[model samples]
Target chain A: MRVLGIDPGLTRCGVGVVDGAVGRTLTLVAAGAVRTPADEELPARLLGVEQGIEQWLDDYRPDAVAVERVFAQHNVRTVMGTAQAGAIAVVCAARRGLPVALHTPSEVKAAITGSGRADKAQVGAMVARILRLDGPPRPADAADAVALAICHLWRGSAQAHLARARQEFARRIETARQAHGL
Target chain B: MRVLGIDPGLTRCGVGVVDGAVGRTLTLVAAGAVRTPADEELPARLLGVEQGIEQWLDDYRPDAVAVERVFAQHNVRTVMGTAQAGAIAVVCAARRGLPVALHTPSEVKAAITGSGRADKAQVGAMVARILRLDGPPRPADAADAVALAICHLWRGSAQAHLARARQEFARRIETARQAHGL
Candidate 1:
């Protein structure tokens, strides 16, 4: 399945699309950054980001979306913006009825570089190597987005399968219990 | 002018609409909470918030929107959710070409009550008095939303006027410069 990954930020949001599934060779479809002027008003800036993501979603039409899950940052302002941007992406995907997955930064790095502690450059190099490109995607944000897509393609599918299986198991048990009239 | 205030939260988003100006007696047109199940997935929860805010905007058609600005919290998860929910409100208003204002919690409290450090109960009491209600709005979140609306009506109008004055000044300056032919 095709996956679109988003590294959400107010000033510079990263988006990448990849075609692949677990145990399959992933192919890069698109990668870029959505930029909004820092000097612009917050609402306008967010609108720009929202419009850009919508454009990407409309163009790429990915099967699933993966967004970076924001955690606390020492800089609360930055963290707030990041979380807001990520949340918009989530809403966008949900509106389209697409399943959305959130991957932590460490999880993305580990999935792409075999180490959760991998540095930016290391992860970038690995992304390039795995995608069989001449070099890493331009701009660190784009590379990070690509890494997020790769991580979700590699790891998220299994998690989704597990969740579905658990739900199905519960449903079967409930049916059996009802049959027993409990 | 009519103002819609939003106190955004993942589980319980508060929304209120008021009609008044800074020097006028504000009337509460509507006040309530948009609740999402805590057990829902993050994307679904955010979707609920987005839709709720959109519905409020559509129903009230307020001239402006005011959202409670989220700050750093000891609970990072809660803060993230709040920020995301607030962002959606901003986006919804911006999409409608409505001006949006953000007031910090302390700012809202100070505007409604006499003190920035006022407790929720005090703020609630003050909101009820200012709105001339028999009692404070039910559910602390709803009161907070009312507080946000009152705060914006109290302060945002002046800011808007100032901005308009500045724009008019710039326009006159530009016209004079053009008349000088250089």
Candidate 2:
């Protein structure tokens, strides 16, 4: 399965795509960020974000999208910007009929580092080690996104397996119905 | 000056335009909403939002945009949707080189009514009375957007006055420098 993970921000959004199978090795396909000028008008910034996401979607074509869920904060402006970025990810994933999985920061950290309170450096190190890369990803945001993708890959396999089981059960039911002429 | 107020949402965004001058009465120029299919992919929905905002911008040509600032909630999905909608509004205003102002729900309520804790219905009623409209604006969201625009108009005028003062001061300095051959 191919998974695309995203860390959304108003100024910069980091995205990573990973391809792999359950109980098997995973590969990093693509990674980058969409950045907008801080001084630019909000509309232009959003357009830059949209265009960047579109390009990534077209290029990667991941089967699923994993996005970090927005967490509540005391700062209204920061919360607002993060929320907007999160929405862009949802729109991008929803438009393509790609199933989206949301992962909280804690969940991703626990999945990757076996600790819910793992710091950025720890999570980045874990991601780099797991992916068998030379070094940790730059711009911590990007590394977090990659870790989110890894978490999804680990969790998503269970979902894929369940779906396959359901399909097989439906097929068996249909075969039995045919035999009974019902 | 003409001010456009926008209430951003995932499925629908309400827009209202008001025209007025400082120390003069404000008039509602136009009001409507842009709706998108919830089931469509996120990108398509975003495109719909962009087109919708573009149409309104072209039709109204407002001097400024006033958008409601999104607040973070416990529901990550809902928060994400609101954020995306907010970004679209920002992008719409920026593309036309129009200044964009953001107002919190409480701020808009306080501007329309005496209390910041006023509910949507009370705020809608106040908006209708303030705008001298025939009736309460349909779709409460649309009325809230109008209120937000009114708030911006009031606040923007104050900001403009300060900006103008600064510009005049700078111009006087330049004139003095030229006269002194400095």
Candidate 3:
């Protein structure tokens, strides 16, 4: 399945699409950033972000979307903008009826580099190697987005399968209980 | 002018519509909360917020919207959710082409109670008094939302006039400069 990962921000939002499936090699379909001017009003900037993500979703048509979940940070202003951007991305995907996943920074690092504590360089190196790129993706945000897509592709499939299994198991248990009339 | 104030949150998004202009008695047209269960997924919750805000906009048809500006907090998760909700409210207003304003907590408090550090009880009390209600609005979120609307109605008109004057002044200056060929 193809996955679109978004590293959401107001001034710059990173987007990367990856074509992959469970236990298969992943390929980079596209990588870029959506940017709004710092001087613009908040509402306009937000609308720009929403429109940008919607366009990307329409163009790439990824099976799923992965967004970097906002976490508490020392910089409240930055975190608020990131969270806003991330939320807009999720809304855009949901409006299109596409499945969305949120991956924390550590989670993306762990999935991409096998270490929750991996540094940015390590994650970038791993993403480059996995995607078979000669050099790391330009603009750290874009690389981070690629890493997010790769992480989602690698981890989300397993999680979805597990969820399905659990649901099926619950269904069978309910059916058995009904048959027994207990 | 009519103002729709939003107290943005993930679980309970408070909305209040107040009708009045500057130097006039404000009336609370509607006050309530748009609720989303905490048990729901993030995307679904975000969608709920979007839909809720859209419904309010459609129902009230307010001339302007005021959202509480989220600040960095000790609790990062709560702040993130609040910021996301606030952003969605802004987007909803912008989509409807209504002017949007963001009032900080301190600003709202000061506008309502004459003190930036006024307690919630003081703010709620003031809201009841301003709206000429016998008792405080139910749910602190709803009261706070009313305060947001009141604040915007009192402060936003002056700001809007100033903005328009500035725009007109700039236009005149450009015209004069062009005429002078300097």
Can you list the residue pairs that collide in candidate 3? none
- On residues B1-182, what C-alpha lDDT tens digit does candidate 3 reach at each position? 88999999999998999999756788999999999999999899999999999999889999989999887864777888898888889998987788998999999999999999999999989999999998768777889898999999888777878898999999999999999996
Candidate 1 chain A: 10-residue stretch with minimal lDDT: A71-80
- What is the per-residue lDDT of model 1 for residues B34-68, given as tens digits with 9 covering 90 to 100? 99999999999988998888888889999989998
- lDDT string, candidate 1, A22-118, tens digits: 6678899999999999999989998999999999999999999999989886487789889889988899999999999999999999899889999
How far does residue A39 in candidate 1 sit from its true spot (Å)? 0.4
Interface RMSD of 1: 1.4
TM-score of each: 0.87, 0.73, 0.87
Q: Could you give the interface RMSD of each candidate, to one decimal? A: 1.4, 4.2, 1.0
* TM-scores of chain A, one for each prediction: 0.86, 0.86, 0.86
Model 1: what is its DockQ? 0.60
Clashing pairs in 2: A42-B90, A43-B90, A43-B91, A84-B83, A91-B42, A94-B41, A94-B42, A95-B41, A95-B42
Ranking by lDDT: 1, 3, 2
Q: How many steric overlaps are in each model, in order?
A: 0, 9, 0
Q: Give the Å error, residue B15, model 1.
A: 0.8
Number of the predicted model whose DockQ against the real structure is largest = 3
